[model samples]
Target: MKSTVETLSPTRVRLAIEVPFVELEPSLKKAYREIAQQVQIPGFRRGRVPAAVIDQRVGRAAVINEAVQEAIPAQILAAVREHDVKMLGRPELETFPELEDGQPLKFTAEIDVRPEIALPDLSTLEISVDELQIADSEIDEQVKGLQERFATLKTVERPAQDGDYVQIDLAATVDGEEVPGGSATNISHEVGSKQLLPGLDEVLVSMSAGDANTFTSQLVGGDFAGRDADVSVSVRTVKEKQLPALDDEFAQLASEFDTLEELRNDLRERVTRVKKVEQLYAARDKALAELVRIADVPAPEGVVREEVDHRKQAMADQLERIGASLDEYLAAEEKTEEQIDTELAEAATEGVKIQLLLDTLADAEDVQVSDDEFGHEIMHRAQRAGVQPQQYYDQLVRAGNAGAVFGDVRRGKALALVMDRIKITDAAGNELNMDDLRGGSAEHDHDHDH
Candidate 1:
């Protein structure tokens, strides 16, 4: 057996292979055995049929076809490995082998390959991240958020106001007829929250209990989606949230802290930690951006086009599930289809560039994803998806995406590697030490949920 490669492009190759007829003898024998077990014969049992009998009954063409089917993939893999090509997707058979008795079999396979990339020097790259500073207002906001969580709702005998909760019955009619599935009773809604329907907040506020009003708005979903409907709301109850005073008693009830001062201090520290985490994320992102900006990585058109198509299909699927069309989506987003397409193309190009860069870096740095890392990533994804780890793992395996997961983990580590070598400065012009932020680990300890 022999193989040679033809460079069709930087990201594609064609392989020509020649295998001696004797090399396929084993595959031919196995094919014969398989056919024998499938065909019924007069004097021979299923497993006892001879190769000659199979050839005579099934014909030489059937045997050759089966053998080639079993042999081509293995032969292509061997050729790819021998040529050290980082193949992508499946190989396309450009030429099929013709089997002649005692003659060598020949064929050609065309495949997409990962393009070679030259990585930039990591030390030369510098990025700036936002300084970690917790403002007093931010801390106050956090405290207020905690207070809201512990607040109690009290029924009020006054008109509904912004930030108040209201219980109301809602009904909708189109063209003087009540729309199907367009009414609900005693639905709780926040007065200023427009989440239920357009222009609902304005009508709900300034209305006291037992007061009703109708407003015309476009229904965005359900059976009457995209149609104008008269929405009527009758307030059953109005309630205002009563927050406890920020005193020691309230602090003790809300948290483990014994005093309000202590609780405020803890909240400040928590906000500070969150800011630091943001800076870490910014650093990682900026590091990758700088690396790609400096590296001469070429994007493979096939991969980029495939990614773009997948993204489009995913968006279409999501919109379909929500009973929305592309025009509805564009209108909601306040953008045109042409703008979205341009943005998707740009994003896809950048995505491919970063992937190629990271993969090259992973190879150069000899980055390896340990079994522990892979399992941890799967568990993290499962937790996010609200599923069991084994279930998620099985799904990935069945979808043949397990390798993609491993590749993502490896690329994350590779980016983390570049993060370690690059220099980062805060807005204050102070050199930031990421080691303290990373718990003294140069590499990120968390798994990437790709």
Candidate 2:
């Protein structure tokens, strides 16, 4: 087989392959034998038919077509290897015939190739990261939030007031016709909490138990939109929240802390950890932005196009999952597909640029993950994802995404090196600790929304 390559673009290539007749002859003979075994002739046994006889009966074109199908993929692979083309996805094949036996098998394949990238100067880049100090008031507020979580709801024999919880049955009608999704039975609603609707909370305040009231409001943003709704609600009971006493016993009951002071200390540490993580993220963002600004390298167009296409497909899939058509989603979001694509193109381009920049930095710095570091990182991610480490590893391997995990680690190490070289300071000009920022706490839910 002989091959030639042409550069279509910086990120695309075309390969022309020519296979000699002798190389394709074996496949042609195999095709003939298979056909003979499947068919019967007048003078020969079913399995004993000759290649010439089978070719005469089944046409040379059919045999050659079968042979071409089997040979094209291997030939393409060989040609790609010979040309030293680093391809991204599968190659598209187009074949043309050269006459019989001693003639060549000719085909052209178009493929996306990985672009050669150059490393940029990283030592000259600078970034500023803010240092945050945990405040006493913030710690107190977090403690109050925890106490609220342990609060009890108590029945009250009085009229329902603002901030009181009320159990009620509600129904709504518009133009004397009952509106869909405007009714609920035995639902507990907090007056002035704004849980149900905007104005409905105000209307529920100051009503006594067993009282029925009616009000009119406009429907908001869903299936009965743009119509006035007349609603009637009857209160069955009124209740108030009774918070737990802020004492040593209360702290012991709420958490592992034995005293209120201990709990407050823990909360203060948690707040510090959270602020540090936020600071680290902010610093990373600033550093990346600076790198992009300083790096003088062109991104591969193929990577940018692939990223844009993947993002569009993801958005389409998300809309489908949410029970909305692409058109409906675009209309609701006030954007057309083209408009979305245009908006995402810049971000996609930047993403490819950043990837190439980081990869180059990793190479320049000789950043690498040791086996221990890789294991630790994988286990840490698995713990955060609530899965076994081996399970997550197996999943990454199966999906062919194991390289992605290593890429993330390498990028992180590269950023750390960049951070070390640059001077990070707060707005007040004090030095900040990157390690403190890196070792921050994860978020925990104190309420359903949190």
* lDDT agreement with native, every candidate: 0.85, 0.77
| Candidate 2 CA-lDDT value | 0.77
Candidate 1, residues 286-336, lDDT tens digits: the string is: 777777777766677777778889889989999999878998789889999
Model 2 / residue 130 / CA error / Å? 2.9
lDDT of 2 by residue, 1-450 (tens): 999999987667899888988899878877777777888999999889987887788777788877877788888889888878877656776545444655788878888776666554555655666658777889879988998899888888877788788999989888888888788999988788777855677677777789898887877645766688888989988899888999999999999999999999988888877887777667766877777776554666767787888888887888878877776667668898888889878878877777667777788778889888778778877887799999999998999988878877777667667767765777677777766666732322100010
Off by over 4 Å in 1: 20-22, 29-63, 94-106, 247-249, 305-331, 334-348, 369-371, 378-402, 439-450
Error of 2 at 214 (Å): 4.4
> Candidate 2: misplaced stretches above 4 Å?
4-10, 14-73, 90-110, 133-137, 157-162, 171-183, 197-199, 214-231, 242-265, 312-346, 365-399, 403-416, 441-450
Clashes of 1: 0
